[model samples]
Target chain A: MSAARVGVVTFPGTLDDQDAARAVRLVGAQAVPLWHADRDLKGVDAVFLPGGFSYGDYLRCGAISRFAPLMEEIVPAAKAGLPVIGTCNGFQILCEAHLLPGALTRNASLHYVCRDQRLRVEQTATAWTNTFAAGQEIVLPVKHGEGRYVADADTLAALEAGDHVVVRYLGGNPNGSLNDIAGIRNEAGNVVGLMPHPEHAVEELVGAPSTDGLGFFTSILKNLVNA
Target chain B: MARVIVDVMLKPEILDPQGQAIARALPRLGFSGVSSVRQGKRFEIELEGAADEAALAEVRKMAETLLANTVIEDYSVRVEG
Candidate 1:
């Protein structure tokens, strides 16, 4: 089977685009670099918006990057069932774009945090998390200042009803995110946004005891193959 | 043109550890009566025309659709001529 083409978008000040691309390569997929200013999708099978302090996190973490030219195209593609994953700042952009509900606020402590976190996969139906069994626990790296997730009572109820909550922090709440949610999926389940940095944890040598982060990239490949 | 000022803040139910930390530090700095501090974002939007009902509606749409999350953050818009 041919390798799936996964595009990793890089906005100005993006910090993890390279790591995301490498993760894709490690998972046997072609990693395509996408520039924020480019409107084209490059015919990639899947897309990942890597973590970063896009636009210097000026107005908000993902605020300025949401207006980037690429989002104009990505937003439509994501709605049409294209698989997209956003990590950390990328998750903020997804929220800013309205592709996903909820917003990431400053860490309850309001201080920048960096740590290895354990997360439980709550749903395995999304394109970016299908490889994991439901309720599986995996360790990945999380680094950010604004990572707390907040949603309205009604929206939170709706998300629970739809089973859209994807991943939750295991053990301790890292940033005081509501419900300890580390990640979530859109109603379509094709788009996912998470606070953790799976790309940075893909290699066991550099990250935790296992290469659990590889599941994210591998999941997308399986989703494309099955589709 | 009309101007719309939108203030966005984290919901009160959620703990504001950052705010508490600052509040704690204030008393130590010898500045009495510094009760509290809550951090948030403020946006100033200039409308296409004078502040009016119609322009305010457009600004509201912008806030709901993009400017604010409306989930954990509450936004209030004030219109001024």
Candidate 2:
């Protein structure tokens, strides 16, 4: 069978599109580069919104990018069960697009934080996380100024009820996310948004102590192969 | 003209470590009797030519649907002549 095509979107100021595409290729999938101005999804099997300061982080992290022409197509595609993953600024974009719940605000300390963060896989049922066992700890890079996730009580309850809380900070809460949540998945389990940068941690030589981030890419490939 | 004030916050049940950290620091800063602080964002929007109730409704819809997360926040709209 042919390899699954994973599109990594590149916004004007995106910094990690190449890393995400490389991660996809490392996991035996074809990585397609997508542009924010392009309206077509290019018939990719899945998509990844990689991290970066899109549009210079003006207005809000992902607020401007949500209106990108590509998102017009991506929103419906994602709703139709096309796998989608967002990291950092991409996560901010997903929330702005209303594809995910909550908003990412300035860090509680009001500073840009960059670190190798420890996160636990809270839910392994999502298309991007199926390779991980529940409660598995992984280290990934988190670099952002406004990474704090905020949502109302009912929404938080609903997410918990739906098992959409995908990843939680294992030790220190990096950006003051509620319940130590570092990532979340949509109700369909095909779309996920995460604050940490899994793409940055996919290689053992350059990444954390363990190359745990590759599982995210491999999980999507595995899902596509199984489907 | 109609003025809308939107306040966004994390749900009360969820822990606000930032708030907690600030609350804990207040005592050390020599600010006695400062009991607590919960941080949130406030948006003040003024609508022009939106004097009618219909216009007000439109602005409210915008706030509910995009400007704010209703799950953790409650917004109130005030109309002034």
Candidate 3:
């Protein structure tokens, strides 16, 4: 069988698409480049929305990118079970697009936080997290000015009840996200969004602290093969 | 041409740290007696024609779709000469 192919989307202001694609290639998967303006998804099995100041973070983080031509295709595909994972600014786009519930707001401290953050893996059933052990802790780099995750009471309750919280910040909440939510998955478990840059932590030689983030890429490849 | 103004503010339940920072600095600057402060955004859109109900409605849609994220904000639209 051929190697799995994953699409890495690049918007006008995207900065991490290259790193994301490198991570995909490191995992032995074909990394297909997807453009924000293009309507085609390139027949990739999964899509990765890398972190960066997309659209210069104009209007709001991820607000303008939500209407990108590629997003119009991705939104419906995600709803139909096309696996998708977004990190940082990409996570903001997911929220803005309503692919996932809730919204990411300014940090409670009103500062741009950039550091290695410890996160607890809360769910392993999702396509992107199946390689991780439940309750396992890992470190990933987080750098963003507006990474606070917020939701209404009922929505938070529902996410909790459905076991949709994929990961939670451990030790300390860097951005004051509600419930220390670092990552979340849809009910179907095919779509996931998180604030930390896993793509930046796939290798230790590049000073990533740890190679713990390679699991996310590997998990998707394995899942696509099985499917 | 007429102007359509849209004001977008965070929801009351959500925390506004930027506003809090300003509110905290106000007292130190000798400005007192203010209870609180909440920051928001205002956009003044110049319309090509009269600011009739139809034009106002279009601006409202723009506010809803772009100017404000209703998940954590509320917006008000009005017209001015």
Fnat of each prediction? 0.65, 0.15, 0.80
- Kindly report which residue stretches of model 2 are placed more than 4 angstroms away from their true locations once superposed: A207-209, B1-81
List residue ranges in candidate 1 displaced over 4 A.
A207-209, B1-6, B11-15, B31-36, B43-67, B78-81
The residue-by-residue lDDT of candidate 2 on A1-227, one tens digit each, is: 89999999999999999999988999889999999999989999999999988999875578779889999999999999999999999999999888999878767776689888888899999999999988898888889888888887788899988899999887788777777889999999999999998898888877365688899999999999999
Task: List TM-score (chain A only) for every prediction.
Answer: 0.98, 0.98, 0.99
Reference-based TM-score, model 2: 0.81
Output the worst ten-in-a-row residue range by lDDT, candidate 2 chain A: A202-211
Q: Which digits, one per residue and each the tens of the lDDT, describe model 3 over residues A96-170?
A: 999999999999999899999999999999999999999999999999989999999999999999999999999
- Higher DockQ: candidate 2 or 3? 3
Per-residue lDDT over B1-81 for candidate 2, one digit per residue giving the tens place of the 0 to 100 score: 566666666566645556878889898988889777776667777877665778778878876766655544555665644
| lDDT for residue B15 in candidate 3, whole number 0-100 | 93
- How would you encode candidate 1's per-residue C-alpha lDDT over A44-96 as one tens digit per residue? 99999999889899866788899899999999999999999999999999998
Cα shift from native, residue B78, model 2 (Å): 7.1
Ranking by DockQ: 3, 1, 2
